[model samples]
Target chain A: MYRQDEVKEASFFDTGEGLVFSYGPQHPGTGHFRLIVRVIGDTVLSAEPDPGFVHRGEEKLCEYKTWITNIPHLERPAILDAAGMLYPYCLAVEKLMGVEPPLRARYIRPIVAELNRIGSHFYYFALYGVFLGLTTPFMWAFGDREFVVDLVQFIGGQRITHSYFVPGGVRNDVPKRVPSGLVKQFRAWYRDATGRSPSSDELTDDFQKYVLRVMEFLDARLDHYWDLMLNNALFMDRTVNVGKLTAEEAAKLGVVGVTLRATGIKRDVRIDEPYDAYGEFKFDVPVRTEGDSYARAVVAFEEMRQSIRIITQAVEGLPDGPVKNKQHPVNIRVPAGEAIARAEAAHGESVYYVRSDGTDRPYRVRMLTASFRNLIVIPYLSRGAKLAEIPAIYWSQNVWPVEWDR
Target chain B: MSESKIGYIVNELKQALGESIKEVKIDKKMTKITVEKDALVRAASVLKGLGFDHVKGVTGIDLIALKPPEDSFEVMYHAGSYSVQELANIIVTIATRIPRNNPEVPSLTSIWPSCEYHERETYEMFGIIFSGHPNLKRLLLPEWWSDAPPLRKDYRPPGR
Candidate 1:
């Protein structure tokens, strides 16, 4: 039996010139993360983000795996939004191979991608809800997010780390679940919406209509989210002015995704550098200038709404064609080239730099994920802010330490 | 064709830097600008001046084979823009090569503050020291980790 007397105890009373405190390496609020903070009373003087607790040497290991096998490995770091993390990799590999994914694959890709985006945002929202001590929001967000999970599994064949994406296009086509007449109507609506919708003559299938229903359900859920969580005065007070970041600060710090959008910087990789159905979809890049914790939360909420719109448009505009190019899924051989590809992931921009050596294996794979890029701002924000507000600011950024450590 | 955005940038760089720009390769969406290590600071500054502000990541690639008689290491600085709408569409990777034996280069933290963490990462990952960095310490690895920089091509993990 382990001896209780052998355990060392920490004393909070023993304070001297900037007492060093360990925030977490293992705490519910902080999942596998630590902040070595030098604090003077309630305010933090300096915060050093000590990450890599979950470092599995993803980059080094990527050099060994085949281009096809690497998708699952790369997707593991970011479990919440597998498509967002994997999309850039597939795009870069495709670019290297000099083959274009077919039209149907392009349209279908965004449907799953947008659903993953919504899922990632909902996961963050649930965590934010818990971090703020509101159990109701946590439960609600988690439950609602599962609808997206179920939908993706229906099409993708796996709920997490789908590995559904290949170099040329998606690994599998969407399963048929819709009638030809309704799909035609949806296709017409989609063409009207985007103006350049390619003829998916292969016929719109069952999955498109099924996802449309899911989108409608989520659209209604967003209104309820506002009422239960966003509109609450207590929740608003905790986040309104906490951990304020200016637009300039966001720009200089390489901030992307929701955090950048919250600072009134209309930077979204989907629109700025469109990939896989984004160019075909018409949607507004939501921006809020508050540049505070509350603003980031609001931006995330609005982004979910926008993602719903994107999915709805994509499903309605379901085109017919192959979901993949004429490349082998498992035995893909990319030509020698290097490409930097980025996608608008839920948290931020997920960037991948792939250097292929005309083989199944890559020479190097560098994933400068949004969470990793956003690592610099922790010290900047936490330096003078109150300790209690750290969780709100940190969670609002939607940064996953697992992804950061990767 | 006159020049793509990438080619235009490469031409401007070649003109701006007489001999310091060692080589330049323009990929699809990204441009690889290789500069002499001594001129990295100036090149980074010029890129910053051209609206490539934030350093996305600083990666150290070791090309030296086993038993280290060897070649050179390349330090790639991934830079992109946010404020500059036109420039944001392009990713310019400034790759500078240094002798593997003396893997040292001037830090770009002075030009772009965002490179601080990345510089520290490069420092710890490949043992490539960055000169003039404010606080350069172990980032991902534990403080007591006593192994060769794990990402190096020649580095062999225990029992491998």
Candidate 2:
């Protein structure tokens, strides 16, 4: 069933170089999508992605829901990163209806968004390690991530799908005891895992230092799995320069986040178009000019560090106020008009364009997700790469099908 | 750009398109501009020349139940450019209302290739035919599936 010829016909691959194969829809490496690859002997020729298996008609569903009711529904698409996904939609709706959230709500939103980002990055790291054949890192990263999830549950009343963010404010306030508890857990986790306390000041240091520590720990264990895992002689030999996408191609496709940064575009919606508390944070948008599988890995690691920096600043400088604005009922009507809102998610930028015609429900709701934009790059980058390197390239790209299909 | 500048840009576009521009109205938050079906491509060309390169999203709104003399549909093409950050949040929608029986509009795919999938999606869900679309297959729906246009105001699910 896993043979190359059978997989080839069932998938979509480039028609040149060697026989590039596809593994997906049910492949272990691909989270929840299908991959079509063109292989030139052991090398990859090109990769074309075929997604949409999990399409739930989310945008269409929004048209049937009231403005407030849609909050919980929106979290279902990307359950693991609820705050990041819903905040932009809430912001857009607020902007459209002329509702301004209080200062306290703004700070709380960022706090939750950062915590969600931490959990998401850890999830990514765990998945990345798992795909690279390093089970220990996967276990360790997931174990640490659970602590953050616990904090979310404590404040939001639910772990993954918190629907905590609303148009005018968050559903509830961060519990008084929650912040200190998280800080304690973070400290203990850092010391136990690394065998040394990350200086209290160091936790608040430049984003790079925090990232360097995490990468250093991962790097120290590198030799144990080198040829057998991530940088294995076989893995590097197959992936080093394969699936290359130059900066020009990335920009043309409007690929944002790490994929675009990997091509040296330096386009981060957070930095380029700051929203929420992002403008106040100091962090670098990591870029790599290599535009290959290895470069993508480096970009992801660097981004994890930047996220940590943003979160630290948010927690330390968090202000006080209601997390949401006082507003009319959740079923309040919106005047007839259209508005588009977007935010930088872990994968890339997710955009939502909503149209309301003086009604309780929206006239139309269109979502252009990050995964949809990033998926286009696969076909372009996969060209001229070998077959055996398919999984490595796919995993490195961090394509999440649920986000794409929804 | 100030709110006045955005107004100026809209006025400039209206004047440049002349009679091709049907209706241009600025809502509280966003601006709405409608054009004739025949002049849609030409108007898009003018907008592109004025620096609206990226098509952020293409949205279709079904107005079947409004039951106007001409059963109406509104399709919006939200365009923006990064060079003009102020204009980034300003969405210029080019809408057209076609007859419900024959909802065929000229394809913008030739002008903006990125709109191909978006238009196809509209075509599948709302049954709005883009006359010159290169590949007009169903996107989110299965090819063998049969159902009324899902996004239409009159589209009722099987049980309901």
Backbone N/Cα/C clashes per model: 5, 20
Best by DockQ: 1
Global fold similarity of model 1 (TM-score): 0.90
Model 1: how far is A406 from its true place, Å? 0.8
lDDT of each candidate versus the true structure: 0.80, 0.68
Q: How much DockQ does model 1 earn?
A: 0.43
Query: For residues A6-98, could you state the per-residue lDDT of candidate 2 as single tens digits?
Result: 243323443543564556768555346666655645545445566666777787788778888888888777788888679778877877888
In the predicted model 1, the residue pairs found to clash are A177-A206, A178-A206, A186-A316, A200-A319, A200-A320
Evaluated with lDDT, which candidate comes out highest? 1
Question: Per-residue lDDT tens digits of candidate 1, residues A281-355?
Answer: 889889999899889989999988889989888878888877887766578788776888888877788888888
Among incorrect, acceptable, medium and high, the docking class of model 1 is acceptable
Model 1 Cα shift for residue A9 (angstroms): 32
